[model samples]
Each structure stands twice: as structure tokens, then as C-alpha cells.
Target: MKGVSLAPGDYIHFKSQVPLHKIPIGTKQWRYYDFGPKVVSPLICLPGIAGTADIYYKQIMSLSMKGYRVISVDIPQVWNHQEWIQSFEKFLDVINVHHIHLYGTSLGGFLAQLFAQHRPRRVKSLILSNAFLETRSFAAAMPWAPIVGWSPSFLLKRYVLTGIRDGPHEPFIADSVDFVVSQVETLSRDDLASRLTLTVDTATVEPLLLSDSFITIMDTNNYSAIPQQLKDQLSERYPGARRAYLKTGGDFPFLSRPDEVNLHLQLHLRQVGVEARPDLVQSIPKGGTGGSPSKESDKKKDPDDQPKDNGGNPESTSEESQLPPSSEIHSLDDQLLSDARICSMGHEDAIILMQSQYTVVNRILQSACELFIFSLLPIYVESSYVTSNNVWKFRQLM
Candidate 1:
């Protein structure tokens, strides 16, 4: 019943739109997805134990397109909280992003608070999702934390996956869960073990200098892997913090309920005084912010805009539905043809062009890539074209 849209299509769109970058700060290798204009202060997202940087592809796609700088990062295999703080500091320094708005989920939330507590100036604001204030209860439950690193991958995955509740979920929620399971499957033994170790490690987030007004506690109302008591304690800790509660976003609101989550994020960004890049603010296609496309992109509504119907609904294709109407596919084929011409002209070897993988590749090609993804990929999303695995095989075409 559920249509998986993010993979090979939207997901590959994300990959093409915002290329992944790995920055090695000494022993710690950080894998992250960064997008949007470089001028604005970036909103950095940290995922929980069962997730990876790719988990926030929705955030990257939705917000970055609208002019916000969003960076989604994976939790490296750091053993402890103190090391995490240090490694994270070095990561920021390497990237040269002086100030950031930290958005963390579960363990990532706890880590965000922990980092803000230690390095107050670097963090402009904090958004904690399904986060806890302390690890005492977690440590108590995981009595075998000391031996976590030695645990086998299956055992570690079992332990980490226990946090996500199992049930007959709605199609979207089921798709979200399926996506998460796929991400968890990508984790290395050390990655899973270290994340579990951090969850159980005895650490508490102390009070911070940042105002509660600058913090947004975004949590799901339904159910969370983190206990309700912890969520309550966190709310109590920062009584002045803004509350952005979702009506029904299970553990991963940013995944299962993206529009709501993105809405909250944009509001929080505004509250925190972070401005969208002015140059990009109006150029957003489809849902335009008063900016018109240039001469080249004349007919194209922002190339990144999802393929939508005349009713303004995202054109969705369930397993039960037929291929999208020919007009739409024809539109996509034309843009992809344009994209091919652009890529070929930009680089002598088209293969090298795709391989170069610059984040921006400048505005002209950025729009071209966006056109390439939205034009070609949505057809794949709206109809079952191929699995995400096949997307990697797309490289073999070159």
C-alpha cells in the first residue's frame, strides 16, 4: 500500500542535489550531507543510534531547496561523549562554519545539548527530537555496555533496533520504518556498537548559557523509544524552550511526517534569527517565494520541486497505480535531455562530470542537476522503475 519515494529517485535526487562529503578529522571520519547557500548559518542534524546521515534526506531536500543551509551527519564510531564533543568541535573547525544551529534526534539530541553546554558560542540554537536529559536509565537497562564493542553485528543491531517499536503501522510509517531498517543495515559493527555504547554511557546534559527561547523541543506525541519521563524532564529543564510537538510522528518525525517536521524547522530557524539566503529565497520553484526563473529555466518551476499534479498534490504512485501520465514523463525526458546537454558542455567527459561531485558546481549546473533529478527521478518515484540498488548500477552506464 505504501509507496517508497525516497530511494533511487528522490534519494538519488538528494545524492545528486546535495553530494555527500566525508571529512576526516584525525581518527574520526565524518560522513555528512550539506546543501543550500553557504552564506547562512547551517542547521546541523544529528541522528540517533539506528540512523545515518541519509535519514534526514527529507530535511535536506525540503529545507535546502527553500534556501536554508542544512547539514545532516552520521554519528561516527566514537566511544564516549567527551570524545564526541572534541571530535565534533574539530569537525566544525575543519568545515569553517563558525556558528551552527544544532538539531539532534534521540542520542543526537542528547549530544547536541551536551555540545552546546561545552561550547556555548559555536551553537546558536538547539532543536532536540525525542531526546533524553540523562543516560542513567539507559545505562541501567544496558548492563552489558562494557562488552558492547565486542558484540557481534547481529546482536548489536538487535539491541539498537529494540528502540523502534514494532506494530502494524500506517503505510507511511511502515515505509519510514523500512527506510530506517535499511539504514541500520548499512552500519558497520563498530558503528552500531559505538552508538549503543554512547546510548548507555553515563553522561548527563548540564544546564547551558543558551536561552531556552533559542531551543525548540520537537517531539512526537504518539510514542518514542526514549521514555516519556525523560522527555518530561527535558521539558522541565528548559521551561522557556519553544515546543513543537507533532500529532503522530512515531520515533522519526522528520522521516514519517516531513512536511510537519520541515514546517517546525523553518519556524525555529526564523525564531533563531537565521535567514534564508536572499539570492535563493525567491527562486524556489513550484512554491515560489516571488522569484521568477531566469531565461534558461524559463518554463521550469524550480527544477527541484517534486513532480506534482494540477491539484498541487505530490504525484504519488502506489504499487496498484499505473505509470504517471505521459505528459509528465515527456516533460521529464525533455529536462533530462537538457541536463545531458548541459553536463556534456560543462565537462569534456560526462563521466568525469558526474564523478567530480561538487556541492554547488555553481548556480547554473546546480539548477541543471535539480532539473535532472526532479525531471527524471519523480517518474521513478511515482512509478516502480527499479530498486535503489539499481541506482548505484546507474554508474555502470558511464
Candidate 2:
């Protein structure tokens, strides 16, 4: 796909009442392509750090093929955070879409979460792949490089490339790096400075990176580095919400594993009852859980351990139900805790623990009790014994 280049002030606040034909987004009118399918939902794709709206061309096309109304924006070099929000609002207004399913990557994922947090009603569902939920890691990972260029391409592909090189989109990063390195050979210092400014201006968090942003980054990193507790936090934050883990790493999974990303998106949209193209089925990967536990969960168990329900399921064991006996829980629990790296006091401890009478209800209750111990010991409890909301909810169910 050819790139779409726009000057700094080229298309800000531009409006087109009718969907413009396959025109350039910046050359003249604000272009909007009509892939001409009765899309199940309108989608907005945002780029990551130093990414142009054009970088997602393959994604936009792939999604369009699946009957989606897709909009890929040309992010202004330096945009006011509020104005960007308004730009999204205006896009929805022009497109006459009340709600949208958003798929954001990296910085775009960060921004998408912010948008959903602030405007929950407008977001139908969100899929954030290889994105930073916080900025601390980003700051820690990439200390400031001198602003030596004007175009975003040079610095993004050169200086920032290292941070995302091992990311999900290794192929894209490789090609991008080659292109930028070649472009850098001939770029003047002033041009480099301009590109640095463009990159920084586009990627910088509005109103400065706040403590919340840092917390999100920390939590997201924790999600990978410490899977068990992070999954617990996510479950707490979005109760009854559906979530999944994609096998790829870094950011930009959409670019690296477009079909996988697309499959996840399709599944999520379906779960929410949103309209989507059925052709998405072919894009799904085999042997992957549609939305079930990944094998990472299976490896984290104590071998001799008894099953701990942890209030997850409560199916009774009986001839009619044919539910597996106590052995099943012990086996599954091991998988659930594998990535957690938190031991269940070892196999002997699990064996001793499992010797007692077992029932689905009892297993769930015991699991809740264990989680309560881990979660509420530090918090103040003036009037009640439990301080954490998650524990309280579990107690209610128990």
C-alpha cells in the first residue's frame, strides 16, 4: 500500500458531509472509503507511537473485507487531547454511528482505554493488543533522545525501534526499521529534528503522563510479569466483562497477527451481540481457545495438589451430572496457577489440603476464603470484616 503523507496543519478540523470517495485524506478533501459492505459495526483504528493512520492500511482493508465500516484517521502531528476526543465525536456524528467497536494498538490502545473509561456508553467493546496501559514502563524503557529530526518516520524507526523490535509485529518493525534507516542516511539534522518533534508531539500523553497512567502501565506490565494477580485485578475492574490473551508479544499484535487479532475482535463483538461478518470464522486460529483458559494457566499447579474452586464454578458431582470427582479440580487448579508462579505450598501441601471432604460448593467457598486472605489483610475495616470489593462480592455469592 502507498503511504498517505500530510503536512502538520493539512487536515485538522476538515469536514466532509458525504463519504468522500477513495480520495487522499490530506491532499484535498477529508477522504472516507466505502468498502461497500453492510458492515456489522463501525470501527475506528488508531495507531501506536510514531504511527501514521496509514500504517494500519492492511488492517483497515482486512476488516473491510469482513463487512466492517472502517475509519482510519490521520492523526495531527501535535493534537490537543480535547480536540482529538472531539474529532472522534465528529467522526461518529458524520458517520451517524452512536457507538463503535474500537481496536487500538500501543499508544492508540492507551488512548482507546481512556476514551472508554471516560465515555463508556459510546464504546461498544474494546480490544487493546500490545498497548501500554501505563507510561512508567514507556518512560523507563525509552529515555529521551535528542530531537534531531522533523519527520516522525526517522526517529520512530530508528531511536524508538529498539523498544518495540521484539514486539508482536517483528516483521513490520523490521521493514519499518529498514525504511527509516535508509531514509535517515539522507535526512538533514533539521529534518531529523522536525521528525522528532512530530513523533514526540503525536505520542506524548495529554496533560502530561499522570500517576494513573503510570499505574495502568504498572498494572499492564504486572499482567504479563505477574499473571495471576493481574488477572485478578482485571476481573475486579471489569466484572462480567469478557477478556482474552493473545500469544504474541510486545505491541502491535494487529500488524503481526492480523488474523488472530481479527478473530479475537470478532469473538468479542459476537459475545456482546454486536453485528459482524460471519466470514471472520475462517480467520480464527485452530487449537486456540475461542475464549477459554490458555495452556499458561495449566502449567501453574502443584502436582499433588487438591482442586481449589475459588468460587469459579459450583457444578455438583452426581451420577446424573457426571461431573468429575475431586481429582478434576486439583488438575485444573495446577494449570490456573502455572503462570502465576505463586506456589500452592508445593505438592505435599496440596495433597494434605485435598484430603478433606470435597464438593463443588465447598471448593468455591474455600477459594473465596483464600482470595480474601490475600486481598483484604492490608485495608482498614472500620465497620466490616472485609474491605475489598472483590472479597465482598465473593462473600455475597458464598
**lDDT (Cα, tens digit) per residue for candidate 1, span 1-398:** 12222242445444544455665669888877655655567899999998899999878766654567777889998999999999998877655566899999999999999999999988889999999999999989887888998999999988877778998887668878878887888899999989888988888888999999999999888888888999999999999999998889888888788778887898899988987653553432332211111233344342223221111112111111111112221232353343323323332343344434433355678798889888987788756656665776887886
Those runs of model 1 whose alpha carbons end farther than 4 Å from true positions after fitting are 1-8, 281-398
Which 10-residue window in model 2 sums to the lowest lDDT? Answer: 1-10
| Clash-forming residue pairs, model 1 | 285-302
- Tens-place lDDT per residue, model 2, 231-318, is 3543444444445565542344444344555555555556556554434323322221111112343343421132211111111111
Residue range with the least summed lDDT across 10 consecutive positions in model 1: 310-319
- Please give the lDDT score for candidate 2: 0.41
Off by over 4 Å in 2: 1-39, 136-157, 166-241, 277-398
Top TM-score prediction, candidate number: 1
